[model samples]
Target: MKKSLICALVIYCFSSVAAYAAENPSVKALLSEMSKASQQLNYQLSYIVINRNTIEPLRYSHAVENNVQLAHLVYLSGPMREIIRRGGEVSYIDSSSEPFTIRANYMVAPTIPLLNSNINELSKYYDFVLLGKAREAGATCQVLRVVSKDGMRYSYVLWVDEKTKLPLRADLVDRDGDILEQFRTISLAVGDGVSKALGELQNVQLPQVLSLPQGNLTHTYWKVSWVPNGFKPEELNRYKLSGTNQMVESQLYSDGLFDFSVYVSDRNDQSLKSQLVRQGRRSLQIYVSGKNEVAVIGDIPPETALRIARSVKFSPVAAKKVADSNAVNNSPETDVAPESSSQ
Candidate 1:
């Protein structure tokens, strides 16, 4: 009996060490390879996005020409929609939104997830665990899970092609382990041929990149007291509702991979009661403060959105100060006239 117990204890220790190694640097290295392969290789991915009862097919082609990244995405079946990326300029052509171009390194459309994500930064707040190999899109792929450290946000299960290091499929999972959406590749092609095919974009005329107005970062009356570990707040934006002309304030927070926005507005008949709603990968939570409504919306768990909404704090004096500052900034001279050195 004593001899058997000693053997079992030794086996457990070795197993624990092996598990640690598999979850740590090894997983991160694989993810790093995936990110590198995505940027360097000229490839095309034909995939489908499944969300609830809807399934949409799309095609994405990416290439690097003259050291500049170029990509194109097209909706395969629906009304004509295409997103083109020529280096830093990304143009969106869709029926719903006006055709426009923006200066951005990555296309914000529904392309492959984590294609350009910063793996080093995400590893700080999430753990990457290897789940061995699986077959996806007619290729042998390595499987992994990106789990949240605090279990307060969603997670992802990814299948990456073993030979090419390209992501083949990714599923967004909520806290309860239910899949909210999935991106699965139906076919893939990689080589210089794909690059030559996309070279025609060099001469394709794209719209001028829009110059977005800078947001005023002045402090506001409302404050979000708490957020997830890696989340960081962005600039505050103040605006008015179109028809009602009611003033509203909003600030966006991001943790590199996921982001959410907090909105504060005076409570009125249109203000929704405290509630939480989650659809696909988006969660929206509204909380009623004294005379204000705090809403948290983004790609987080419902519980997390609720907690963020509840943690908001507001002050009446600060509100007045912000209002006065906005009034001065909106004055006719400042709005309609360019700056002068003498003024």
Candidate 2:
């Protein structure tokens, strides 16, 4: 009789686990629909990006034609700045610089978050939790939370429109549940007319893609000993800060949803022994170690940034390679620091 009871208990436990797993697919399906709708539908969204001290309004329109994606984003308040994406190339137009195009699949500027993110790829590191429903942007929407599995990274609360499945709002929140940055839609229009409006992009003449210089691949003695799982490093870079001209070496890492960069440089007069700063979705942490100053900065929590900065350690490499490169600014062939980019 005890054996039968134990068998029944085991079967019940397995069934409970199976039931819980089955429920997750529905939540993931909602997000999958949101991702598909963002890429497949012709829509227009007028939204405002809100931080602790600033609010910036913008408009974005997207459409897909002949298997080519077309998008345009315009800043409504600032000096006329716009990002235009036609197929795989994205062009930037603004008053400060001449119109230029870059090879990219999505607009890098601040737009609705997670519109083009890979739902399956993110599922590995994040948990999609359904948080019921709410009304947003004049429509009934489904509320969902994309929580980090490890709790070491920031999370997002998303409001997806029920009818259109388009994202209406997203909030980047810390582990303590404080919002760092918000993307809220003020108005949304879903129809083919939006596509018709963006169709003119085919006729607009965009500049050729700029030939971007590659990152400095020089091996360094400094190494980051630890990073959260799912984060992968890119090529190492050595460059001079445009203003201070401080020679620094940096390595950027990303986990598809977030990014952070580790910077190492010799201690100088301007070096700070310890500092931590958090602004919007970005955090910067700097600490002095021995004769070098290390910093970790990106869209992450302040504590994580500081931990990453502290985790950087010295690794002895070939003495000949260190000698050949000598110092950060010693080599004249090193590339200038490029603007920060996300995966």
| Model 2 vs. true fold: TM | 0.86
lDDT digits (tens) for residues 1-343 of candidate 2:
9999999999999999999766434778999999999999999999999999999999999999899999999999969999999999999999998999999897879988889989998999999999888999889988999999988899999999988999999999999899989999999998989999999999998899999877755456677877877898987877778877466788889888899989888788878879988777898999898878999999988888888888877643432344355454486344332323222
Cα lDDT of candidate 1 equals 0.85
Q: Per-prediction TM-score, please? A: 0.88, 0.86
Worst 10 contiguous positions by lDDT, candidate 2: 334-343
What lDDT does the true structure give each of the candidates? 0.85, 0.85
- Residue-level lDDT of model 1, residues 206-311, one tens digit each, is 8888998665645667678889899988766767777865777788898888899988888989888999887889998999998899989999988899988888
Count clashes in each candidate, considering only residues at least 3 apart in sequence or on different chains: 0, 0
lDDT of 1 at 101: 93
- Superposition error at 15 for model 1 (Å): 16
